[model samples]
Target: MRVSLCVLLPFVFFAQTAQYTKDIEVVKVGVIFFNNELELVRAFDTAIRDINELELDVRLEPLKHFVSEDDSLTLQEFACELIDNGVAAIFGPSAKASSDIVEVICNTTGIPHLQFDWHEENFYIHTRNHKLTVNVAPAENMLATAFLDILHMKQLDWKSFTIVYENSRSLGRMELIFGWRQVHKAGIKLWHFNRGDDYRILWKLVSSTREKNVVLDCPADIITEVLNASIYYNMTGQFNQWFLTSLDTHTSTIRSLNSRQFIAKMVAVRVRAYMPPPVHDEADVF
Candidate 1:
């Protein structure tokens, strides 16, 4: 139920190395976002307020530029605008594809890119300049370790499991899990549940496979639907087990999950952890 994520030295260095004049100092940062997440918006505003209250030598001016999630040209144009306006760092645009585009633009402009999402495996194969990419989220390797630890704790063989994911971002985890199997000399099947697919059909397919152990990596909003479908199909029992890899699972209703007709066997893992700031301090880390 508990998870931890640490922001390593590289990010600290970026924050610490902010330049300032003796009389006046300021750091401009840009955020690229496409989703309309009220909580995320609140957090960003909260961060600015906290930073101001700290009365540090340097001040941070954060600007958010929203764009269509799938518009590559718009992403590039907005990124260029941020660079042109003298942003020291850029954060977000959580989608993998958009983040990748923003990353390339940041790298070209030598701006530190802060990301909280997954990166494709192929992107890391090169040894080029990654000095500008600062990921606040846990590293992919850490996720792999956590996942493997879960499987090991459950004493389940890799071959006995199947991975079901929502989109491309989830593919990163799938690939890591697939790679981990090489170490164990085992392999597992992979399935994708697209946005509009019928959950009933998906449940039937899953049931037909007779695969008891399933690792589901999907958005929090879809978890309830998946569970409900499973319940309808009588897929909840000792014979079936589900491992959810979504952080927001903790926020789900416990009573609904513990319905009278079915005994749900589920365990979820969150990849991010928040640490409290020092006593009497309002500063926070993300």
Candidate 2:
């Protein structure tokens, strides 16, 4: 998959106004992240390395800070520190609360801010004045429409289906799907899963409902637990069709959770266009 940073960085630097110096210099780019976002940090580092290889006059340096997503004061401090250190742009703190704090600071300081988190369309409409901020997440309605298209192509008899989502934020991603349910008068059921909840109990309830079509929207970290619970409940059979909304669903960890039987019945959407490498002969599929 093409890392968004790889594409966005060039535009960010080249679009600078005449007020900024045209002379070659080392440009510092700030990154704000949570503790669990090491993968994102690694990706950011890789992107910076790849960009530097172009041998452009402007060299790029990354300044990253790890902060608690809920710590508004600390996040604000970090943002100010990055700006004080002369960063041209800031990326992430993908969680909504922290992102808002950083975005406000960046806006006031006239520094560019970029995000990779999903947000409702109205957010952009309301924050039109914050022209320095850019979000690369796909629009909710667009993603919902894509999901509908995929369902249609699969030709599944999904008159009724259960939507199992991770949190309140995930609900925003489902708005268009909810509208579709209303329009079609489909029997749609909703289930919410929090991090500490018993996965077995959740899957048991779902299994008891005998719902053949299920849509799961959750972070990649918990997918294995969720699927393991479903498997324990015999919910991974050919008759059950699962659609996973996480882009990381195609990762090796997730793919390893599927046997041939499970693979045939499950569908996962990812950002990349490429298909996964074929399962190996000796490797355990489950």
Best by TM-score: 2
Predicted structure with the largest lDDT when compared to the true one: 2
Question: What range of 10 consecutive residues in model 1 has the weakest lDDT sum?
Answer: 1-10
| Candidate 2 ranges with C-alpha deviation above 4 Å | 1-12, 15-22, 96-99, 120-129, 182-186, 260-264, 273-286
Per residue, candidate 1 scores C-alpha lDDT tens digits across 87-131 of 878877664454467777777778877765555545552245455
lDDT of 2 by residue, 1-286 (tens): 2245334744556435212776746788888888777777777788888777874667778899988767888898999999999988888777455346777787888998877766545566337545677776666777877777666653565778898888767776676667667532457788888987899899888888787888898887788777877877778887888878876665537767757546437777766433445633221122
| Candidate 2: clashing residue pairs, number | 0
Candidate 2: residue 271 lDDT (0-100): 66
Q: How many Å off is the CA of 119 in candidate 1?
A: 2.1
TM for every model, in the order presented, reads 0.75, 0.83
Candidate 2 TM-score, C-alpha based: 0.83
